[model samples]
Target: MQAPERIMSCERPDSEEFCYFLAKDYFRFVLDGSESQPAANNVVETLRRSGSSLDRSGRELEHCINKLNLSSIEEVERVLPSLMREIYSDGIDNWGRIVTLYAFCGVLVSNLKKKGVPERELIEGVAQCLAQYTWTHKAAWIKENGGWEKGFVEHFQEKKNSHFYTKIAAFTGIVAAFSFVIYQH
Candidate 1:
């Protein structure tokens, strides 16, 4: 079967986008466990100090994910390698940076939603943005907390055609490949 759709597609702010955004945020923080409250707090403090004027509490979330070294949808495609290395370090074998970027996109969409923007449109925007980086090096990412299969299945249930689903599938594949490679050593 087709593994599933990747989340990069849902980076757009179209209809049904919120479903993906919420699912993305849910997976990163709740499932992936890379997002901590301290990171959220750092984001809030940074925005407040920088006077970014982003009013939603979700902005803190956005800031935190970005700080984790995830790229913003606005980032150019060429800069991803450096960005990924900065976040994942030598574990570049595991596409942790890319995963974090997807997670960050989810947060950005949610932030827009909290700021009174239409959830669907914001989510679609996120998906569209992700579609750009849809082909980042295809490396495996560390499982850190949980396995990708369980997380992807739980996060992308009936939403099979969505960007979130696609991302989960791709993420799972990447992580699985990495695990296989490590096992061979």
Candidate 2:
């Protein structure tokens, strides 16, 4: 985290394709901004298990949700923040909880859509929240952490972050399939 050489602009992220990939790949399911949105119950379980699949943090979050018998969108909605806050505090080398956090958020947003929440609301709300997160809460941390150029590229490197993986070809194509999150447009 040696200051990333240079911090990047939040508007035009240095590691932009990572955001595009998240939108195209990981978040492709809910990318439909169409008018006729599905009701919460009508939505399938495609993202239901996403949170619990990545790592232990996800499992623990799932456990707490289960233990509380929090099955509904309303129920999990109430308590998930506290549980996630705990996980965020743990940090664990920054990369440990990175993908897990996105999976958890993606699960919740997808569920909200299923529960009849409008896509616009979910979309705008996430955008606003990300703005605050990057500019407000973690601005200093993100700056010192090298912003996306170093953070996104280094953290989600495919196989290994060799010189080969440092170029746009590797950054955009290979690593994108199974890696990356956190910095999204």
Candidate 3:
């Protein structure tokens, strides 16, 4: 069991190869409550601004998730894939979109956690779902883009224009909102 799970997790290889673990770990960083959640924290720290601070981003993210109105796991299952399809409708070329996907997963986990989904079940289920997305939708892209290695990291942090912050704002909103939603339920 653990062996299969370790397979699902992203481990750095000696060579540049596509690894699904990067996506799972990014999601798990939230689901498993790991102390270092660089996906969210890094973006939040980079885009820290008044009225759009980390705390505020969470509240705003809560508002965005509320707009989705996902009250049940069934609804989450039915709707999230569709939302994901729409989210990646263009392409996963930019860091903002990738972060938005991260934010989206964060929102779903928050929903599940709020609805009292068991922790082990939630982690396994979400990891599997993300793994599906990893192999199906984004594997080639991850391989081409840098597989969370120098390529992805370099692109992710380079804030070249003002529009980047807008994306950061949206992503942060999703990240910060989870805890509030989780506790409320």
Report the number of the highest-lDDT candidate: 3
Ranking by lDDT: 3, 2, 1
- lDDT by residue for model 2 (23-71), tens: 2233334344332333221111212222223422234433322334433
- Tens digits of per-residue lDDT for model 1 on 1-185? 01132333233322233234333334334322333433222222221222121112124434443333323333323233343333343444322234445554455555545556555454445554453333333212213323233333333333334534444443444344334333432
- 1 versus 2: better lDDT goes to: 2
- Please state the error at residue 161 of candidate 1 in Å: 31
Poorly placed runs, candidate 1 (over 4 Å): 1-61, 64-93, 136-185
In every candidate, how many clashes are there?
A: 26, 4, 5
Q: What TM-score fits each model?
A: 0.32, 0.45, 0.61
Scored by lDDT, model 1 comes in at 0.36
Query: In order, what lDDT does every prediction score?
Result: 0.36, 0.38, 0.50
The TM-score ranking, best first, is 3, 2, 1
Which stretch of 10 consecutive residues in model 2 shows the poorest summed lDDT? 39-48
Model 3: per-residue Cα lDDT over 75-109, one tens digit each: 66666565555555545355455555555566567
